[model samples]
Target: MRGLTAGYGPVRALDGVDVTAERGHITAVLGANGAGKTTLLRTISGLVRPTAGSVHVDGTDLTAAAAEKIARAGVAHVPEGRGVITELTVEENLRLGALLGSARKRTERTAEDVYTMFPALAERRRRDAHTLSGGERQMLVIGRALVSGPDVLLLDEPSLGLAPRIVSQIFGMLRDLVRETELAILLVEQNARSALSIADVGVVLGLGRVVATAPAAELAADDALRHAYLGF
Candidate 1:
């Protein structure tokens, strides 16, 4: 994204934001509640249209593309809500993800891979999503997105309402996924410490724009910045 801008009526949510999520790496976006982190993901996923600038994936301009078009281009967004269909069974939800973009061809095989990645889901494949715990729900949503076979994965506030151990487990899996599968991840998180722990790059947003962009360790080591903006 370069000079990306998006808004809701009179209030601008994303103001001239510039960032990148490289393949085989994790780029974390950290900020306060209203710091435009979620908006950035929405814009890139086509949930919200940009008022200005450009969004490119694998060198293709997706600035004005529709949501489906963006997904077809290999961008999968797991929004803040954990987006599980409560009425659907675990396997059914996983199958839903396979319908999006290019993953449509290998739904069964991908579902098996997702079950392998998330053994808990495999154990409860016949249960409705509403019956799962918070951590299980989070895993289901992420596994759903993974089966889509996207090149870029955008995660929004994935650590919300989860235990520290569960968060660590999920983040650890993300690190392995990036290294083994070479997929790029753009993670928007409020858990600055955990996010930075696995990130290759970290981008800090304040108000509606970026205030800092640096390697993960550098950002984590910045005491002043952490105390002021990251609350760590």
Candidate 2:
């Protein structure tokens, strides 16, 4: 995204946002609540139309395209709420994601692959999604997104409302996922420390604008920046 701008009605949540999530890397978008982190992902996924700038995957321009069109273009967004079909079983949820994925990915990444990635989910494959714990639900949603075989994965607050151990497990899995595949992950999080620990690069936002953009370690090491914008 370059010079991306979007909002809800008159409130501009994202203003002139410039970001690039490269393949094989995790770019963490860190900020306090209402810092426009969610808007960034929504705009890129075409859920919120951008009033300015462009969003492209590989080489195709997808500015203001339909959400479904963007998904087919290989961008999968796992929103903050750990969204899943409560009525479906663990395995069924993954299969649904694969079916909605691009035709090529349906064959490339299957539900079995997701089960392999998250063994906890594999253990509960037959259970309904609503029966899982908070951490398990988070894993299930991410696993479902992975089954889509997206080139770019947008994850919002994956660590929210989870224990430290569970957060570490999920973050470690994300780090390994990018290392093993060409997939790029744009992670949006209020948990700056956890996000920076696994991210290759960091982009900090404040009041709908980028306050800092640098290597994740550098940002993590900056005491003033962390306290000022990151809040941890």
Candidate 3:
């Protein structure tokens, strides 16, 4: 996105922002609360429209597109809080993901692939989503998005309240997914240290704009930036 600007009422959540996510790479967007990290992903996914700037994927402009249109364009968004359907069984929830606009064929094989990616969900295929732990719910949500065959995945604060071990496990899988599937991930997280450990690149946002953009290791190594924005 270039020159992106968005807001709610008179409050500008995003201001003249520019960012990019490459295939097979993980770009971590880190900031404190209310720094516009969530707003960045929301604008990209069309949940919120940008007042200016263009959101282009492979040369197709998606800035003015609707949320559904953007999803069909292979940009899937997993909002904060896991966004799982508590009433639906694991399999039912997975099926809902494929029901959306997707270019690939949704077959039993595809369902099997999702189960393969998340064995815990497979074990609880018949169980309601709310029965699962926080980490399990997170995996289920990510696997559901994968079922849609999206090229770009925008994940918001995925490590919110999970244990460190669970967070590590999930981040490890995300790195592997990027390498194996060549999908681009834009990870928004308050867990700067964890996010930088696995991310290929990092973008630090402050107030409503980018303050730093660099290689993940470089960003982590910068003492001033880390202390000022990363809270580490």
lDDT per residue for candidate 1 within 13-128, as digits (tens), equals 98999998899999999989899999999999999999999999989899999999899778889999888999999999998888874542222338788778778889999999
Instruction: Flag regions of model 3 displaced more than 4 Å.
Output: 104-109
lDDT of 3 by residue, 104-183 (tens): 33322266787887787789999999999999999888888888888889999899999999899899989988988768
Q: Rank the candidates by lDDT, best first.
A: 2, 1, 3
lDDT of 1: 0.91
Per-candidate alpha-carbon RMSD to the true structure: 1.8, 1.2, 1.8
Q: How accurate is candidate 3 locally (lDDT)?
A: 0.89
Per-residue alpha-carbon lDDT of model 2 for 1-232, expressed as tens digits? 9999999999999999999899999999998889999999999998899999999888889996899989988899999998989999998999888877865452377777777878899899999999999999999999888888888999999999999999999999999999989899999999999899999999999999999999999999999999999887
User: What is the lDDT, from 0 to 100, of the residue 45 in candidate 2?
Assistant: 91
Give lDDT: candidate 3, residue 27. Answer: 99
In model 1, the clashing pairs are none
